[model samples]
Target: MTAVVSNSTEYLLGQSLSSRDDDNHNIYTNLLYLDTSSPGFNDPITFPKDPKERENLLELPGNRKVLIAQPAVVTDVGDNIRHYTLDCHGFQYVNHTTKCSKEMFLDETMIKASYYPEVDQLIKDVTGASYVHLFDYAARGPLNGDDGDPKINRPVKSVHCDQSYEGAKRVVMSRLPDKAFAEEVVENRRFQIMNIWRPLEPIYKDPFAVTDARSIPDSDLVALPVIAGDYTEESWAAEPNSAHRWYFKFAQKPDEVLMFKCFDLVRKRMSPVEYFMLRLRTGLKSICPHDKALRSELVWFTVNSSSNQIHDRYL
Candidate 1:
């Protein structure tokens, strides 16, 4: 753990007025639902992968109306995962079992790492997960200041949860395919959208911030429609509430992973960017704030375990 640098973006929890161009660079505090009938939506969203595109990545044409605000208390969170998120649900952090090799990120042998089994074993050791699936692996870089390069994915600075209830159900159905198996899995197994997120290098500027789910009531979550590539997914946007609590372990390192729940079976269960560093009121910060790029790798998959066991022996 090196010295961590801290920064803040004024996120917009309420709706004012924004434009399509501000989508990637700006995060809206208000919940903006999807209007798929809008023009060019059916058209392929292909474009030159340039600075402008990355900055406005979240932008889409749609009809959205602002909703009422919710009430709550806001608290600053500590770096301990077990205290804030794991036992609390929604998110958790843990130390890696071994040293990190940067080469694994670039090889892209479909993410064929020698220690992959070891990694899964580590995940099982912590979560008591019987089936740990590695579905996707991606590398994200940090906010690219003038010196920032576009080739790398940036460390997301936006405050948002990745999945909605509908999206989770859709994923389960697509993965399982068999109605009987899917139903049985959904009925008997514990499902979680878990991500093993860690920086490939040391993080100081713009460390990841995860809001405590317990602090947020269901009313504050808005289901916003997001269209990327060929798919449209519904994602939850946290409407800025004064009571929303935010936590982060500053200067996050390569040997540590943020195992977070984008959506879990427990509301019953549920589910960045800078201005290219701020645009929204509750998540606002700057247009560009870095002179270099940040490297990070996140491998996420849903795990199903018939039994819930805590493997704290190694810890």
Candidate 2:
């Protein structure tokens, strides 16, 4: 497949907002793709089930971007086989509990002080990461616009990848100030870059959607270096392509959780840099859209807190 950069220009005049304007009543569709050459990318792997990988040796590092995905399934995503290799699929829907009030998630302090442990355990339970150190959390994605709704956290409608392999390590390092302890933990065990997304209220207007890692070609991903507040990191963005498939469930209730992987030790790791670009959904919105008194944004990184595994940093 030939990967082509959709436009010669990479800048945009206005920021695009995310909405259900492109929904079709069918709630499903198959997207087409015309491939071309992408600057830098390689070592594409299949997901959780098939650990096989296809490499493009022509692609180089320091300027590479790759995409990963998992196809849609109506069955419950919580019952996954842990013994299988997670190379083919990059995302999953797990049933989890936040144990925090809607208000607590909205407040950063309340989340760290009271709800951090629950998330810590969730990561441990699912990924088998004996010890997790959470360096940061965001009340990402605006959940609602109702009276008390904190709408500042609007969703980034543009498709872009933020967490890179190095960024994932930085996240771990940020949590563990003791460099020696961090090295010991990561070296001994595998860690994953995962995120937890849920709705605070019954969702209404704009809901979240993700591209299946399967939809993206390894060459199609463009990596770029990012300067976050305190650290410089690497991230991913997809150049526009039709072959890319995007999916979202109808009316994801508050009880369900969307768990997706970004980078993992088990997968091929590469260092690359490219600007962010992604295939945007172009179509119609759903016919039976619900009313949104408000939408609640519930999301955070998952990790475990095991003091014995490393040093006594928590102490």
| lDDT tens digits, residue span 1-315, model 2 | 111111111211111112223433222221112122443332231112121211231132332333322122111122232211223455544556567778676677787887777767666665556556565555544322232333333333234554555555666666577888777645544455555556676543344445556666667655556544456565555555555544444556665565556655541234354323222111111111223422333323333322112112211
> What TM-score against the true fold does each predicted structure earn?
0.64, 0.58
In order, what lDDT does every prediction score? Answer: 0.46, 0.42
Worst 10 residues of 2 by lDDT: 1-10
Clashes of each: 30, 37
Model 1 spans with C-alpha error above 4 angstroms? 1-82, 98-100, 145-151, 176-180, 266-299, 302-314
Per TM-score, the best of the predicted structures is 1
